[model samples]
Target: MFRFALSLTLALLATQATAAEAEPRWMVTTTGGAFARDNDQAHSFGSLAVTRKIGRGYVSASVTRFGSAVRQVDVTLPSTYTIGFLSAGAVHGAWFYDGYVSLGRQHYKSVVTDLGERDVAGFSHSPVYGAGGDLGAVRWIGRSWSVTPSASLQWIKSRALRGQIGPRGGSEFETRETGVTLGAGLRVDKFFGASHGDSVSLRLTRFQTTNASAALSSGMRGAFNPSAQSGRTSDAWAEVGASATWRVDHRLYLDVGAVRTLGALGGDMTTGSAGARLLF
Candidate 1:
């Protein structure tokens, strides 16, 4: 965790050092939602990002944290943290490309339960790493509107045991997955009393998996065949979200939004969030 934080701090410093003198640009967002049948489990996430102009493009970095808790159970899962590095290619007229790589770490905790006068529990932890990249283009459609489309791929590898039932009876597992995601959105400038700099956006996205693997330690094995494993068990689903950002000043802003999954993923996983941003 310390290393991740340090890396992000250095990246931010380097970006700021090379930034051109212009209007401050930065974003911070927080989101929380529930998952599971009947919304029995809840998840929360938050992120901070900053962007600065460099040459004809932009450089940015962001840090994020997310965790989940059960509704009826008193157990809270460990939180995960991620740091990202981003580069935006020079704009060619009205088109450009953006890419990013991210490093992530997941921390897990033991589960605890109380039955009559007995307390039962077990705990464990693991660290996972992943990288992802994206390519996107934006084109002006008219005076106050534009369209952006993007595609992204992500992969993650598990490094240790992710869960446990008891201290003495636990197994190690590793996971690998690759995902392809596509997104399209429309941006409208100066809507609902917002300034020209302020914008509202509606976006739809779909994510599909091409490969997935789950490997267990020799001592802790399951009947599931390794050949039968696939990266994603569920089919692709669409997500729709709306966001509006209002600038309180050149350095301060507010952003809010709601996102819901449109198909199968929607039944148990939907999220809504709002947050603030500060630039320096």
Candidate 2:
């Protein structure tokens, strides 16, 4: 997937270079990073995006691959996701509006653990799909600052899964799980440099969960259901971050940032990332 996106982006870059004598109309960005969790567990992610000017705004597409960790009482399930997105944005004076929709595939690993006198079990491989979208707006403050507020929604569904729990080989059960997340955030930015293109920003976001449920059947009933067995159903959490951007030239820019997720399941997570963008 990364190869395909990179190839397409390169092709577009070459095709658009002819028009670079005028104001550039296309942008390409690539970012990659890792985040840390409990027990020294580290997960990695990478993404590529291409954007083109359209009328008074812009249209974009992106591909991403990332790893996420889910904690059960005694075990951690590591999952990987591959996602693609289509996005669009429009500017009206000092106000800009944007939205994006995404589709993704997810894979989870089966795990098993021993807890003193008992054992917690594992889940069978099952088909999983996730879909989501976001709506956001930015309000420019004078020539050197801006404020952005946004809302997002996501849904994840899993096919019937066979699971096991208990001692020895454990009891077997079947279940299906679905979850939803709703989030809102605000960001403030301070731009500098002669071109006002370089900037530093601070952001705060909160997420709430709903209908994160599971249907369990067969042996041991709820013993192995992912959503049903979780410690919280309607939990909420917040994240805070700061970042900086450097305008390297008329056609290139670089970024570095860090964010921390607080009150998340399992424990807090800290992420560090760096990336570059090219305009042509």
Candidate 3:
């Protein structure tokens, strides 16, 4: 009867396209690390990320690099380069929401030591931007375990610390900050293969700030304002990690990790990483 109802509607549309290709819309990650900060003295960074999924919502993009320290007392006087942009979607099924914006640029060259005579310093630049938003929720608690919680808000524009030390000596300064962050994490996957995967995580993060202050003068109204400069100098940091992924076949993949930065921002910082991931 009419070819058996057109072969049962083409076998139910090929079983809904094989259940949407078995889920997992997209994912890509790459990381590299080595960092230590406590008045400056360690460097190494690399990052690449991409995530995509639409219909339940998801989107992401990232790129990062930070490495420059050959000597000069481990450099940190003014070394920089950071860039990020992200967007997210998901209003159900584990809940999700995201937003991100970042930009940073700073170069170095500074030496101001009088009495013994040593000069020739000129290199200072600043370009900062910020925007942030996050609200995430995930729960699985079984078969591999999973739990995630997140909250964030950020607004910063602290860029103005130029340099020059001789031939007229130059300088510049400015600061404006607003931050709030809260995070929670737990992800354990042990090990799984067919494509390879391993995971371990423990995280805790906290940050608070408001209004900030810092100003110097020569061009922007001879600035210099510092009246008690808010509160809570620094206190809150924790990150534990373990990650591994290997799928060197389908579209390439490899990731390794290590992280440490427990308590304090003016001292104590550690990180280690390895990476290679490509998917399309």
TM-score of each: 0.64, 0.72, 0.28
Q: Candidate 2: list runs displaced more than 4 Å.
A: 1-21, 38-40, 110-128, 158-163, 166-175, 211-232
lDDT of 2 by residue, 56-166 (tens): 667888877776545455555555666677776665543445555656655555444454332223443445555555555556687677777767666656543233455
lDDT of 3 at 118: 30
- The candidates, ranked best first by lDDT, are 2, 3, 1
- What does the lDDT read for residue 188 in candidate 3? 41
Candidate 3 or 1, higher TM-score: 1
| Deviation (Å) of 159 in candidate 1 | 5.4
Question: 1-280, model 3: which lDDT tens digit per residue?
Answer: 0000111111211222323245445667666665654455566666566776565556767656564321222112334456464555454555556556666554543433333323224435556556555565555565454555555555545443323334664333333443333334443434344422333444444434343222110001111111113332323445455555555654455656555545543344455567765545
Ranked candidates, highest TM-score first = 2, 1, 3
RMSD of 1: 9.3
**Whole-model Cα lDDT per candidate?**
0.41, 0.56, 0.43
The best candidate by TM-score is: 2
